[model samples]
Target: MTIVLHGIRNCDTMKKAFAWLDGQGLDWRLHDYKKEGIDRARLEGWVAKLGWEALLNRAGTTFRKLPDAEKAGLDAGKAVALMLAQPSMIKRPVAVAGEALLVGFDPARWSATLK
Candidate 1:
């Protein structure tokens, strides 16, 4: 199974995830959102599995900087559009392992899912 880890390379959370994966000795690939850029199809696929709320990074600076009007009225469609426009607004370190897509960094959840 191909394990793909997607996030900004410099993110502290991403670094921790990477370190954890490395410690586990799992072979995986990194898809840097800043470098590779995210597309609608991939984001949509993840949203379909995990829900837009799980994928959207409301805690991040990118989301905080958005105008109140822009942040308002969020449905799946609008969330996808916003996330597509700004990849950083999507949560960090979304991992795709085989057929599973995991959003955010939770060590216990990751261990369970990845195994």
Candidate 2:
């Protein structure tokens, strides 16, 4: 099975994930939402499974730099809107394999999930 890793190309976490996936000899491809962008339907599906809070990178520079009003009172819809406009605001290295969706990189978790 091929795993699709979604994130920006320059992110440190994505770099690590790429190295790890390569070490494991897995067939993986990058989604690079920063360049390609993510669609509402797919984003909504991920939110349904992973929850928007988990998918949004609130701690990231992009989110932190947002105006106060933009960060306040966020819901799934608003969060989706923000992420759609700035895909970098979404969490890094979200790995998808068939029906499985992983929000962040964890070597142990990934090994188990891929197995």
Candidate 3:
């Protein structure tokens, strides 16, 4: 099975995830969303499985830079739209391993699920 890890290359969380993956000796490819851009269909699929709230990165600078009005009214559709426009606004290191989709870098969860 192919595992695709999506995030910005420079992100510290991504770096940790990469290190973890390397240490585990797992084969995976990194998809730099900032460089390649994100696909709406794939984003929507992740949202469908993980929920928009899970995918949205409200703690990030990109999300913080948005106007107050934009942050106030966030339904799934709006959140997905925002994420599509700004891929950085999506959480770091979204890894897809076979049929399983993982968001964020949880070493414990990775060990349980990916390993």
Candidate 4:
């Protein structure tokens, strides 16, 4: 199984994820969207599995900076559009392990899902 963590390379949460995965002896790789770029197909696939609400990081600065109008109406399409325009808007460390889709950093959940 290919274990890939998607997020910015310099993000603190991403660093923690890196450490945790390394500590667990899992062979994982980082897909820094900022540098590598992300595609709609991949994001949409994740959104389909996890929901756009779970994928969109509203608490991040990128979302916070958006105008009220842009943030007002949100659905799967709008959420995907926003996240597509700004990759940073997606939650950190979205890990795709085989068929499992993990959002954010939760060691317990990751352990359970990965196991």
Query: Where's the lowest-lDDT run of ten residues in candidate 3?
Result: 1-10
For all predicted structures, in order, the TM-scores are: 0.96, 0.96, 0.97, 0.96
Q: List the candidates ranked by lDDT, beginning with the highest.
A: 3, 4, 2, 1
Better of 3 and 4 by lDDT: 3
Q: Write the per-residue lDDT of candidate 2 for residues 1-115, one digit (tens) a residue.
A: 9999999899999999999999999999999886788999999999989889999999999999999999999999999999989998999888999998998889999999986
| Candidate 3 TM-score, C-alpha based | 0.97
Candidate 4 lDDT at 43 equals: 96
- C-alpha lDDT values of all predictions: 0.91, 0.92, 0.93, 0.92
Better of 1 and 4 by lDDT: 4
Q: Indicate the worst ten consecutive residues by lDDT in candidate 1.
A: 20-29
Model 4 spans > 4 angstroms off:
none
TM-score of 4: 0.96
* Superposed model 1: Cα runs more than 4 Å off: none
Could you give candidate 4's per-residue lDDT for residues 1-115 as a string of tens digits? 6599999999999999999998888889889998988899999999988899999999999999999999997999999999999999999989988888899999999989875
Q: Each candidate: how many clashes?
A: 0, 0, 0, 0
TM-score of 1: 0.96
The pairs that clash in candidate 1 are none
Quantify how close model 3 is to the true structure by its C-alpha RMSD in Å. 0.7
C-alpha RMSD between model 4 and the true structure = 0.8
Distance from true location, Cα of 7 in model 4, Å: 0.5
Task: Tell me the lDDT of model 3 at 94.
Answer: 98
Off by over 4 Å in 3: none
